[model samples]
Target: MRPVQRPRRSRRVLLSAAAGAAAVTVAVLAPQQAGALATAAVPVAVVDYDSHDATEYAARWVNPYGPLDGVVPQVDPSGAVTLSDVPFKPGTDFSVFDHLKYIGISTQTFTVPKVGTVTFEVDIAASTPGATPGHVVEGVYGPPGAWSLADPDARPYTATVLEGQQAGVVLNMIDFCTGQLFDWFVAGGSAFPLIERLPTSVTGNTSNPGCPGATEVGLDKAYTQIIKNIPLEPGQTHHVAISFSRSAGQSNVAYALDGQVVATVTNVGIPLDQQGNRYAWTGTYPSLGKGEKLADQINSLSIGHGLFSLLDAFPFQYGCSPPTTSPGAGACSPDSAAYSVSLSPAERSFGQGAEGVFSGFRVTTTGR
Candidate 1:
């Protein structure tokens, strides 16, 4: 399949098109600046899901379930995509997954410049009254390794690479049981800040979704010391941005909430496609024509609402499936998994289903 390229647009024009009705709020989650990496105002591509059919912007909406199951998200006339169904359900039998349904949209995958920075940003708002909180909304950008569109069982491109594994980078807002938002980042197998404790109202309650009696999940310290808590309320819109920068002997990715820098991962390598091709930026997947073999970098990226490894691992990693801490302590435990993948009953309740809006999405690039 050939690459689909959209005419370049300035940040001002792109933002205006996706402004919609609600005003976008920018909050600072960390003290460090995003630096000059993403300072460019012109974008390589601007996908206004609010103004155009999301399909027209990229390749496909790939998922295991169909619209009848409500796993397929709807892009309303207002130009926002709404996820309103329970995609996956794991019964009392914790040993196996009973039902697994997921959905996500992607743009035609594009390679990144060798010496430039690539930024992917989106605006999200909780929509469900009681279901939105305790759920996470994700924004992802990175190299897609070993993912193929031709494979009938191909997982979502956003499926995170396990720890001790190298693929790409990921950033998401964890609006866990407390109904508050927290920043989460993982590159390959390494996750930032080690551990992040939600607000007292969340941790204080033993019955909270993913919070059990234990204080340690993966790390040794609390993430609050470096990141701030943002309320995850219905109808409130927040902007999330992640930038990947590469230069001589240095490669790092920075995450920003609203408009402030929150966390940055350093010493990262250049993101490569499955074909061993080096690309700096990837937004969506382009439609693949017959017989095309270029690495399909497709993912449910434009809005990451998918369940494969992400949902499967969320419980054991954070929920402490068997509530064990020692590495490989229990069968299918967080410690045993390379990437954090724990989902408690309460966490599963939230993950079982959710509703939210993605008002806008864009990707910008700047060369050093």
Candidate 2:
């Protein structure tokens, strides 16, 4: 996506439109320092995505029998899912059957009051099951990366923001299974010299001690630090913050009440080890139009040790329609009924600010 163009600030004074109105009232104002308030404090909205509260947000899909079955027993209106199952044994796999058909469980959209950075606070807790000896579990989805609950060897997870129209720093929280802490300050999409990864500790500390448990990942070119990583104990709560801000190269993007920053990447210019480079790519796919070829967007933020991959499936927003027999048939066609969300000026403003910030909005499914 292209960077957002910032409007030029002018110093010329103009008369107020309501100045001459008879009903208008005036109040005294105090003078402030020049550079003191140079940076505006933008208002940010925090939406919690938990599964326990059903009325808060709407669910796109609900299944009591899937990979998340007894684990994530509840979902809230803010799109938060909570897992309370305990005694999570290592190497044990459970499934919430029939729920795999849907991608997102709950979703919310918010509007940006001003142009600034946006942050997300995600609360994750390991159940009493996870605290047991030999019990282990890993997050299958959410942000990016495969994090093990028991194994201390899994790689950290990565988070990134699509600033303006382009993706920004991809912050990776390296080896993060040890602590119950939160990370902070991931640069928004505007910063360049992109960040690929960042290293973090299980103790919720960003300081590097040069140990085997230290988590390492790739980032484009931004600074970030692990803030929190609360483990699941009996009645324990873990909170994490993924903050986003404007970098040097571009203007800031506005956010809606429902949007949030789930992850971030920190930049470490040098390679982590001598065996090979810190980052690598498998192959490139050609960009194609609707009828040409299908090219997937790059998932700059990812966790674990594997090449990024995209899944080919029916666009959920467009819903399933009658099957087609022609090449590139089915709902994949441009004229299919599967594309429900419009990118027009009116509909696109759901998560934008008056300053013309374009932080891109996501459409979530609601389970009736």
Candidate 3:
């Protein structure tokens, strides 16, 4: 849901495989009016390995808290991408106040018109094993700092944080897929969430019934709510899709996982340029759309895929190194055992493998 600020290299095994190309054509019909006849089918564009630039697609590290070990992406003969364990080597790991995991990102982007419906589809699996499992994200992003009106150039709510405005769906696959471990795995144990970017300008500043003026600053103001929660076993794969639709007198978004509609949002807002045109979805930032004008069109859409660490924040100073701290590390507590190396729980609990068997990544739009 959020992007990492600092990038540090960690020792990892480099496993390479050949890329495979495939394409499928799918046409979906638009919803018909009560009295109208039939609507035309919108053609779907399927993507393949060639669609992504080699230099841009790879597994990498994203440490938001502090220095820590990480893993890299591995492609198999079947074209499945997974994270290969980069065991902790003496000097390779960094000691920090806190630590997060790694991520594998796809650099390609899909366009989002100002109006009409657009759907993004992909298949994912829980290819990791451990108490905690890795998850994959499929999302639509807006301009950087779009949520912070006070400082559009600043990252969201603060200049120190490196996150932007985005709304998407997440799948946390934590099943134990082994036959002997079948009983430990829940039938449908994955958590499907419809996540959104918070409006930093009004979030902590809003007035409430109990607290009239709550201007407390908040970090990682991402609006995440579980629309559907279905568990899955390790190595289990599932289909996922997110659709955005906007037209005359209509505005909504829908999220589907494993062939079922999990969540829907109405009147969704996206990024726009100074001239009021929807920002075009591209690999680069500050890109604007040249299609329909914002006022003249219904809405906008964008797409992305990757595995990002679920970051955690601490409000006090505590770590193996006394006075250890980071951005927003408020104050030092009298008893600093909360962050001592011996007291802190293991941060990296999942094993290495494809976070999911990501495939069939494609988009279909009405071309509004």
Note each model's CA RMSD in angstroms. Answer: 17.9, 21.5, 17.1
RMSD from true fold, candidate 3: 17.1
- What value of lDDT does candidate 2 attain over all alpha carbons? 0.21
Candidate 3 lDDT trough over 10 residues, lowest sum: 14-23
Q: How would you encode candidate 2's per-residue C-alpha lDDT over 270-330 as one tens digit per residue?
A: 2112114433311111111111100111101111100011111112112223223321112
What is candidate 1's CA lDDT for residue 31? 12
How far does residue 288 in candidate 2 sit from its true spot (Å)?
28
TM-score of each: 0.43, 0.28, 0.45
**Tens digit of per-residue lDDT, candidate 1, span 1-368:** 11112233355844443331001111121112223333544234444434346564235444423432344455665555654443234322132231223334342333344444555566554322222223342211111111111334433323322221111122232223221222332221122221123323223434554334423222221122222223332234545565545444444445665555655544331111221333322211111111111111111112333222222322223222432332222333333234333333333333333344555666554442
What TM-score does candidate 2 get on C-alpha atoms? 0.28
lDDT for 339 in candidate 1 is 34
Q: Please tell me which predicted candidate would have the highest TM-score against the true structure.
A: 3
- Write model 3 residue lDDT over 74-152, tens digit each, in one string: 4555444443332222221122222223422233334444334455555555433222323321211112111112333
Query: Which order, best to worst by lDDT?
Result: 1, 3, 2
Task: Please report, in order, the local distance difference test score of every candidate based on alpha carbons.
Answer: 0.33, 0.21, 0.30
Clashes of each: 22, 69, 12
